[model samples]
Target: MLMLRRTKNFLNAHGVEYEKEHVNPLMVPERVYVLKFGKRDGEFLNRFIVEHSYTWTGRDKINKITLRLHGQKHPREFANEAKLLQYLEKHADRYVKKQGNKKAGKNS
Candidate 1:
């Protein structure tokens, strides 16, 4: 109770709530969603085991298909181009940061 009282007294004395509330200026996108897919295990090289089962696809379709057909046969490893830059460049203006008065979460 003493700590809470002290904090309240300090806030009241400082009057920070009225001291020019800083508006977080940002371009709030209309839609927000998570982009999840299989990431390469190698840090130096974004490599993944790709076989005939794992084919390149748009919008992470390949990853989904690989998940479905995984471990059925021997897979051949190859470099996957699922990097953030390539994805963003491919689909421009699709996602944007949602700035609001909310607590940060995972990947936020």
Candidate 2:
């Protein structure tokens, strides 16, 4: 919950309003987070749904997956956006960080 607060605060400080919505159990998500940043292809701002999972299993074995974005049309991995959780905890850096990069930042 602390990480979520900081995330929302960080975005809110940047003049961006972090959005929170009640997730549906049908989506099979335990939680959800979202934010809107500046505009795009049609002069409209793009809002991204930030989805993350800690662990999952298939065939009774651990599965590896990280944060992803579900575009209105399809789901895709936006590697860069992982940095949005830079200041976030919850052992997120392990999956979010790229190889040999000290941390998730613009330079990273």
Candidate 3:
């Protein structure tokens, strides 16, 4: 599966809401993007970002997929999987409401 799809599936399975931002390299003309999750999933998002490496070769290859978990402290430590899940669980209601709003907006 493509990276974006995999990432989206991962978030959906965990009941997290996310937005994707695509960044194209200017010099190499390659496709690269950053997937950013909302503050509700900040902890898990941090872990995902930390575990992945971001590097580019000759600007031609899409080097890295940057995962930005919103509302995290600048330069925060990587959160553990269990902690991330706990955070998500705690905020489940808020996430559900947000998702509902998103769906409603799309319909309109």
- State which candidate has the highest lDDT: 3
Global Cα RMSD, each model = 23.6, 11.5, 10.6
**lDDT of each residue in 5-45, candidate 2, tens digit only:** 55555555544433454333555644444554443443324
Q: Give me the displacement of residue 77 in model 1, in angstroms.
A: 14
Instruction: For residues 1-108, write the lDDT of model 1, one tens digit per residue.
Output: 121233223334433121111122256311111112222342111112222121245122222111111233643321332442344345333322233556777987
Between prediction 1 and prediction 3, the one with superior TM-score is 3
lDDT of model 1, residue 48: 25
TM-score of each: 0.16, 0.34, 0.38
> Cα miss at 2, model 1 (Å)?
45
Winner by lDDT between candidate 3 and candidate 1: 3
> TM-score: which candidate is best?
3
What stretches of model 1 exceed 4 Å from their correct place? 1-84, 98-108
What is the alpha-carbon lDDT for the whole of candidate 1?
Answer: 0.27
Per candidate, the number of residue pairs that clash is: 0, 0, 0
Ranking by lDDT: 3, 2, 1
Q: In model 2, which regions exceed 4 Å deviation?
A: 1-3, 27-29, 37-44, 52-82, 85-108
What is the C-alpha lDDT profile of model 3 across 61-100, one tens digit per residue?
3333332334545533323434444555565564433443
Rank list by TM-score? 3, 2, 1
